[model samples]
Target: MNNPSLISGTTFNEIFAIMEASFPVSEIRTFSGQRALLDNPNYQLFTEKDTEGKTLAFLAAWEFPELRFIEHLAVNPDIRGGGIGNKLMSSYIHRSDKPLLLEVEPPDGELEQRRIGFYERLGFQLNPYSYVQPPLRAGQADLPLRIMTYPQAVTLKEFQRFRDILYTEVYRITVPSSR
Candidate 1:
């Protein structure tokens, strides 16, 4: 089995480049903001590299007491469709017993639908409760997203608690409704 190790320094920079290529700017934090997450005790970044030491895939997650929140998961576009993404996710799940939670764009389009299907194949169930992801940067609007939970569905109460933690800890924003 390929071992997933904590990423840092040049490794982190390389993986960040892949993240920028894979996700829209609005969906990701500024590079500096992401770097700051390295200091957070709850944050974790794990990568799988090739013999050449190039990053093949990465999984960034927050290890909260009640849940494991996958902040991002991406594979190098040059070598996708070879199960690298699956391996990364499987490793993450195998290492944690907590219920896993992650946000996803609603399945309104083909790409979005396919992404949801991909998670479902890994045994993650989509939660129907409404959710809004706080903006990664200032002045941007909150993004509407759906929650997917591993092992089972999440109730509105559970979603609300998760949202509060993410808004306060991850984004440092007060949930509008809470205010």
Candidate 2:
């Protein structure tokens, strides 16, 4: 796995292809917008590639002085159901120096529950505080999501701090209403 601040065009295209296939438009930035994030000192794109140089999985994360938030993680769609996600997450968590956080949809469906379970197996406890993910792009509705934390659960104060950072730093939004 390589967490690179700068990636070659070919590698980026490969990663972006997987991202587009894995996430909805509402959940990701535009191609140019994503490319621009490499300039941000706090952002890192961790990619796991095969011996043949194909991107197997990736995680886009933002680091702060006290915490880290994972924005996106996806396995190449063609290789779905493989152990790549588990391996990728295991590697990332092993390298974390502070509290870790990520967002997930509520367990209202089989797929959502299964996704939460996958992270749970990796040791992320779903936080109980209500959260609504800010619109990632203009005109999109806020996405109802839950935050999962590593090591242990966060208190309401920590959750608020993390959410504030996500709004003011990551999404650059005014605090939006939540559930």
Candidate 3:
């Protein structure tokens, strides 16, 4: 399958709608905040569109010197489970050489566990170390989430490094002393 195209201005609103639908309010950045990320050289929004040009799925990624972080991957809810997601992620992994990292909700429920299993089937290993995703919006407390890495599991030091970079760059916040 061909790789998805980089999202353009014309597709921004449609892509954001997919994101808002895929993630909970506390987990997603504000609309303006998301727009700001598009200007960052490290960030990318890849979208798959139908022949008629309607978006089918998207993968939002951040490229750091040491790692490739998948911030979000959402398929159109109407057409999910039809292998679009697998193709999108496989295309990304085929193009990327850096270690790929992503956050997953802890195995708190069946749906969450299935989400983890989805990545696991794609060859990502779940890390056991504790992780807290700093709030994406104001007035929300830190959220506990797990780190999953493609190719292999991460060491404690590696996890800490990933956490530091995400906290500083993506969330724009200082790592709490308690962590």
Best by lDDT: 2
- TM-score of each predicted structure versus truth: 0.93, 0.94, 0.93
What is the lDDT of every predicted structure here?
A: 0.86, 0.89, 0.87
Model 1 stretches astray by more than 4 angstroms: 1-6, 176-179
Expressed as tens digits, the lDDT of each residue in 1-179 for candidate 3 is 32334556668788888888889997789999888788798888888889988888888888899999999999988899999899989989877778999999999999999999999999999999988888888899988999999999988988888888888888888877665
Model 1's TM-score against the true structure: 0.93
State the local distance difference test value for candidate 1: 0.86
| Residue range 59-122, candidate 2, lDDT tens digits | 8899998899999999998887889888878888988669999999999999999999999999
Instruction: Extract clashing residue pairs from model 2.
Output: none
Task: Give the poorly placed runs of model 2, Cα more than 4 Å off.
Answer: 175-179
- lDDT, residue 51, model 3: 97
